[model samples]
Each structure stands twice: as C-alpha cells, then as structure tokens.
Target: MRATLIYGAGDVRVEEVPDPELREPTDAIVRVVRSCVCGSDLWPYASRPATSEGGRIGHEFLGVVEEVGSEVSGLAAGDLVVAPFVWADNTCDFCSEGLQTSCRHGGGWGQDGVDGGQGEAVRVPQASGTLVKLPVGEDSELLPSLLTLSDVFPTGHHCAVTAGVDERTSVTVIGDGAVGLCAVLAAKRLGAERIVLMGRHAARTDLGREFGATDVVPERGEEGIAQVRDLTGGDGTHRVLECVGTKPALEMALGVIREGGAVSRVGVPQYEEGPMGVAEMFFRNITLTGGVAPARAYIEELLPDVLEGEVRPGRVFDRTVGLDEVPIGYREMADREALKVLVEP
Candidate 1:
C-alpha cells in the first residue's frame, strides 16, 4: 500500500507503507476510493521542521468497507461510507449531545498509531460511530459531493449555524476558500436573505455567487470595511462568518459586523494574538463563537440535499490527481492554482 507522507516544509511524497488491519473490535478497514488535501494541511507543509521519518498525512476521505471488526454492526464489506475527520465513539455523552468532536473517547487522524486518510486503506476506529453509510454505489456521480460531507460542507454549515444566520439576517462571509464558499451555500440553505462574500479571486468568488452570495467585496482592511458597510446601508451586516483563521481575516470579520451582530469562525486559528479582547467585543456587543465542526452530527442532516442535487459542494474541487501525484496537488492548492484538489486512489 502507498500513502502520503510529509518529510518537511514544501515536501510531500507518496511512498509504499504497511497495510492496515483491524486492531479493535470497534474498528473497520476501509479501502479508500476518494481522498483530498485540505487547506489546513498546508500549514504544516509550509512550516513544519524537516524530518527523516515522515508520518502519514491527510484526514479527509471516503471509501468502501473491506472488513469490519467483530463488534461492528449495521455495516459490512462493500458498504460505501464517509469518515468524519475526527473519530469518536457515538455512545459518549458529548456525541449524544451532537458534539462528537469533543467526545470522551474521540481523536483525530495521524495520532495514537492510526493511519491518516490519504492512502489505499485505513483502519477506522469506532467504525459504527464514525462511518456514515451512503446508499449510492461506487460509480455514483455524487461521489465528490458525498465526500464533502466528510468535512468541508459540515464545517461551513457549522460557521453559519453558530453565527445565528436566519431568513431575516444579512450575512457577510470572510475568505473565499473552499470552506468559505461552502459557508455561502450553507447560509442560503438556511434561508439567509442577503450574503456578502469577501474574496479577492474572481474565479472563486464567481463560484461563491453561484452558491448564493448576493455581493462580493474584493477589498481588505479599512477599504473592505467601508465597502461592506456601504453594501449593508452603512449599518453593516447582522451576522458575519469568519472562514479564514489569520489575524487580518479575524479583524476584517470584526470590523464588518454590526454592533449587535455575531461572528462565527470555523477556520483553524493560526495566530496567537490579534484584536480579540474583552473590551473590543464588549463595547461592540458582538458575539464570538465556533470551533472544530461536529461533522458526524451534520452528515445525516446534509446527505439528502447532496443526493437530491440541490447542493453541489463537490464543485469546489477544481483539480484532480492520483495517489502518486499528491505532492503536485498540494503545490497547486498552496500556490492558489487550485481551489481544491481531489485524490482518486
């Protein structure tokens, strides 16, 4: 078997690795059919110190069940399924409350001896709890969109839901990355009447409009703030979705939100310091929320829409590559040459 490994900054390689097998009664071995590089993966690819021993790299994937452990039930060989980025036992209190990301027995990929998702096969812990079966076949045209349910789509939905977006709320989404664009889609699905998407790229923003953004702000800093205010009749939007984790993006989100509005951030925070402070939010009467999305909790809710072709989140994948060409995929996305990269193994 071959899997992606990161040796250091700007270095990603697909090399032969040992095959995975079930080590726990709750585990299942999945034969990966589709996988992709996430924007978050770029952080490590750009800054992690070099190492001679590279570890398995990747966390978003969907596949067919090749085998299931003795304790695993309601799933079997040949079942097509999607694995959320985080693995958890669905029986936990947090999972029951729809917060699987914080499950007592949950963890993410590339940790605790678990192989990452970008490979030929992966050992899925707590298979019954972590894997969502798809009724469609392997050759279904909806594979790309179905794969989005594993992470990005639900993450974007989390941003919108946390921001308190509703039919009467006017919203502004910061960042035009895949997640940002998906936020636009999610906002529309939730009945937001007005959506302002902040993005500089024409190509990506165009897709954002298709996903239901009523306006696109291509400026930054004070200029961007002025533009958003102007678009919202000088009052600013009632809700803002922060999809970029950088300090500047966070600042922009704070700046364009109305005095009584909220900002929901789903982007993985990268900076340690920023304008976020008690006085800043207190004076503005703004609400700040959002964190790692509980993807498993939203998959079932969002699946029917994807299957009905009402939302095509898969269109975010502007490039495709084979397992061996993953390095190139990473470079393309890192260089802004692609919005998203899909891997067919």
Candidate 2:
C-alpha cells in the first residue's frame, strides 16, 4: 500500500506503507477510491518545520469497505461508503446534538496511528458512526460530488446554516476556494436571494456565479468592503461567510457585515486574534459563530441532492491526480494552478 506523508514545508511524498488492520472493534478498513487536497492542507505545506520522519496526511475519502471489525455491524466487506474528516461515535451526546466534530469518542484522521485518506486504504474508527453507506456504485459518475460530503460541502453548509441564511438574507462570502464556492451553493440551496462573493480570481468567481453569487468583488481591504457594501445598498449584507482564515479576511468580514448581521467562519483560523473582539461585534450587536463542521452529521442530508444532480459541489475539483502525483497536486494547489485536486488512489 502507498500513502501520503509530509516531511515538512513543501515536502510531500507518497511511499509504500504498511497496510492497515482493524485495531479496535469499532474499526473498519476502507480502500480509498476518491480523495482530494484541502485548502487547509496548505498551512502545513507552507509552514511546517522540516523533519526527516514525515507524518500521515489527508482527511477526506470514500471507498469500498475491505474489512470490518467483529463488533462493527451494519457494514460488510463490499459496502461503498464515505468517511468524514473526523471519526466520531455517532452515539455520543455531542453527536446526538448534531455536533459530530466534537464527539466525545472521536478524533481526526492521520493521527493516533490511523491511516490518512490520501492513500490506498484507511482504517476508519467508529465505523458504524463514521462511514456513511453510498447508494452509488464504485464507478458512479457522482463519485466526485459524493466525495465532497466528507468535508468541503458540509463545511460550507455549516457556514450558511450557522449564519441563518434564508430567502430574505443577503450574504457576502469571503474567499473563492472550494469551501467558499460551496458556501455560495449552500446559501443558494437555502434560499439566499443576494449572494456576494469576494474573490480576486476570475475563474473561481465565475463558478461562484454559477453557484448563485449575485455579485463578485475582486478587490481587497477597504476597497473590497466598499464594493460589497455598495452591492447591498450600503447595508453590507444580512450575513457574511468568512471562508478565509486570515486576519485580513476576518477584518473584511467584520467590515462588510451589516450592523446586526452574523458572521459564520468555517475556515481554520490562521490568526489567534482579530478585529471582531469588542468594537466590531459587541457594539454592533453582531454574532460570531462557526467551527469545524460536523460533516458526518450532514452527509445524509446532503447526499440526496448530489445524487439528483441538484448541486454539483464537486466542480470545485479542477484537477485530478494518481496516488503518485499527489506531491505535484499539492504544488498545483499551492501555486493556485488548480482549484482543488481529486486524488484517485
């Protein structure tokens, strides 16, 4: 078997690794069919210190079940399933409350001796709670779209859901990455009438329009904020989805939101503090929310739409790579040469 490893900054390698085995009764082994590079993966690619001993990487994938633990029920060796970025026991209190990301018994991929999703196979913990069966076969054309359920799509939906988007709401989504574009689609699906996408790239913003963005602001800082405000009749917007986890994006989010609007950020924050502390959020009566999306909780609800071709969030994947091409895939994403890269391992 071959899996991806990060030796450090700009160092990505795919090498032969030990095949995964069931380590717990709640575990199952999935032979990965489709996976992809996430924007968040770039943080480590850019800043992680150099190391000779690399660690496992990647977190989103779907595949056929190759094995299941004795205690893992409702699954078999041939079931097609998708694994969310986190493995959570759906029976936990947090999971019951629809916060699978915080499940008491759950953890992330590529840690704790678990295999990464960007590989030939992965050992999924809490198998019954984590892996959702797919109605489509291994060869379905919907594989790419269905794969987004593992992370990006659900994350975008969480951003919209947390912001309370509806037909009456006008939204401004920051960033044109996969998650940002998906946020636009999610907002549209939830009936947001006016969608303003803040992105500098024309190609990505073009897809944002297809996903239902009514306006695109390609500027940055004050100029971008002004453009968004102008689009919303000088009122900013009812909600703002901050998909870029940087100080500037946060500042732009607070800057372009209506006084009473809420800002939901699903992007992994790169900064510890920002402009939303007291002056912006407190005095303006604005709400700040959003965290790691409980993607496991959203798969079932979003699956039907993907199956019916109502939403094609997979369009965000503009490139594809084999297991061996993952390093190049990372470079392409880092260089902005690819929107997202689908790894077919």
lDDT of 1: 0.93
Residues 1-345 of candidate 1: C-alpha lDDT, one tens digit per residue: 999999999999999988999999999999999999998899999898999999788989999999999999989999999999999998899999999999999899877789898989999999999999999999999999999998899999999999999999999999999999999999999999899999999999999999999999999999999999999889899899999899888988888999889999999989887675766578889998988899999999999999999999999999999999999999999999999999998
RMSD of each: 0.9, 0.8
For model 2, how does the per-residue alpha-carbon lDDT over 1-345 read when each residue is reduced to its tens digit? 999999999999999999999999989999999999999999999999999899999999999999999999899999999999999999989999999999999999999898989999999999999999999899999999999999999999999999999999999999999999999999999999899999999999999999999999999999999999888788899899999999899999999999889999999999887775678888888999998999998999999999999999999999999999999999999999999999998
lDDT of 1 at 73: 93
TM-score of model 2 (CA atoms): 0.99
Go through the candidates in order and give the clash count of each.
Answer: 0, 0
Residue 27's lDDT within candidate 2 is: 95
TM-score of each: 0.98, 0.99
- What Cα-based lDDT does every candidate model obtain? 0.93, 0.95
Clashing pairs in 2: none
Instruction: Name the lDDT value of residue 122 in candidate 2.
Output: 95
Worst 10 residues of 1 by lDDT: 272-281
TM-score of 1: 0.98
